[model samples]
Target: MNMDIKEIDGACHCGTVRLRVRLSDGLNSARRCTCSYCRMKGAVAVSADLGGVDVLSGADALAIYQFNTMSAKHYFCSKCGIYTHHKRRSNPNQYGVNAAILAGVSPFDFAAVPVMDGINHPSDHAGGPRVVGTLRFVASPGE
Candidate 1:
């Protein structure tokens, strides 16, 4: 591990599963996806290498979910139902870490996040990459 790489600790909501992620690019790689499933889950993900994450415990408590082309493998805690990470479909060599699960990241920290064009994925479309929009989630009480 290089000096720039920082280790972050995280777990499921119920603390059933624990994780230690080696963030090579810190949190700067965080971005949002607009894929059908991703849009529904609404999580901002950060990039990580295949070897960056270690499931410290409760491996059996993790459940895998895959849909559509099934290239991206989404993992969540079966007990608490918290999405921890996923294997990238665009780049199988890399993994997408749940930015919300990483240490020190707050929901208010992000004012806007770039949404990827997962609807017309590069793998399935000929037009290449696209960004849908900058997503905002902040809201006041009772609208």
Candidate 2:
């Protein structure tokens, strides 16, 4: 079956955090991390090369939270505390949008999505795994 994918609008439950992202081609194609915060939040992360995601509104409404190695920049809504997305510590240029944040995207094939070894991260980072695997997109207005 050939399914047409398009840019979908997304936001936090509170509407404080808003985003625009092109859907990934398949289901369960997002990465699940075992890292501390990722485990806690249970975030299913789908990343674009470096420019795929667009933050449409509420830049001021979003808050940046950093911890541990201080490399990853975790972005959440200040009022709702919903983590919308993050920038990789290994690759600051790329944006990792929480697949859960995207509205209308299916999770039917979620189990098929690859589970990346983010627990032992820099090793994966150094080998260019992050850059090699995904389709990169051009940055839109609010990115």
Candidate 3:
């Protein structure tokens, strides 16, 4: 991918929730996590600072979900149940926005994405974060 685009506009599936964000490192910071919550949600996220994301519309329609340590705040569209972004538990200063929701972007855009060891989160461990594996996308024979 280009990795040059810094700002992106996005919305949930229902379009009731819209947002704009300035990526912390363009799309080069995109990645996935292995925690139980992340494993089930299965979103490829890109980094953004806490102040980088702005709710452009329907802020009241956005829903938040937190669990376990409750350090991370996951946001989604209550109407569509589409995950939009989350205040990163690994780095409270950063928010991991759903890459799939970004305009002109998709999880399949990357051939492979690094999978972080969210199961052994840095806050719970002595060492830093680890990359457990890579999630790869192999397109079918034809479109």
Q: Pick the candidate with the highest TM-score.
A: 3
**Per-residue alpha-carbon lDDT of candidate 2 for residues 22-113, written as tens digits (9 for 90 to 100):** 64443233676667787788777776555667788888989998988888889999988989888887568666777767787533435345
Off by over 4 Å in 3: none
Clash count for candidate 1 is 0
- Cα lDDT, all candidates: 0.82, 0.68, 0.94
Q: Poorest 10 consecutive residues of model 1 by lDDT? A: 1-10
Write candidate 1's Cα lDDT for 1-143 as tens digits: 12244778877788888899987677766678878888888888877889998999999999999999989999999988999999989878778888778667754577777878988887887777678788787878895
- Per-residue lDDT over 1-143 for candidate 3, one digit per residue giving the tens place of the 0 to 100 score: 67878898999998999999999899999899999999999999999999999999989999999999999999999999999999988899999999999999999999999999999999998888999999999999995
Ranking by lDDT: 3, 1, 2
Q: lDDT of candidate 2?
A: 0.68
TM-score for each model: 0.86, 0.73, 0.97
The pairs that clash in candidate 1 are none
Judge candidate 2 at residue 90 and give its lDDT.
Answer: 57
Q: Candidate 1 at 5: error in angstroms?
A: 6.6
Model 1 quality (TM-score) = 0.86
Ranking by TM-score: 3, 1, 2
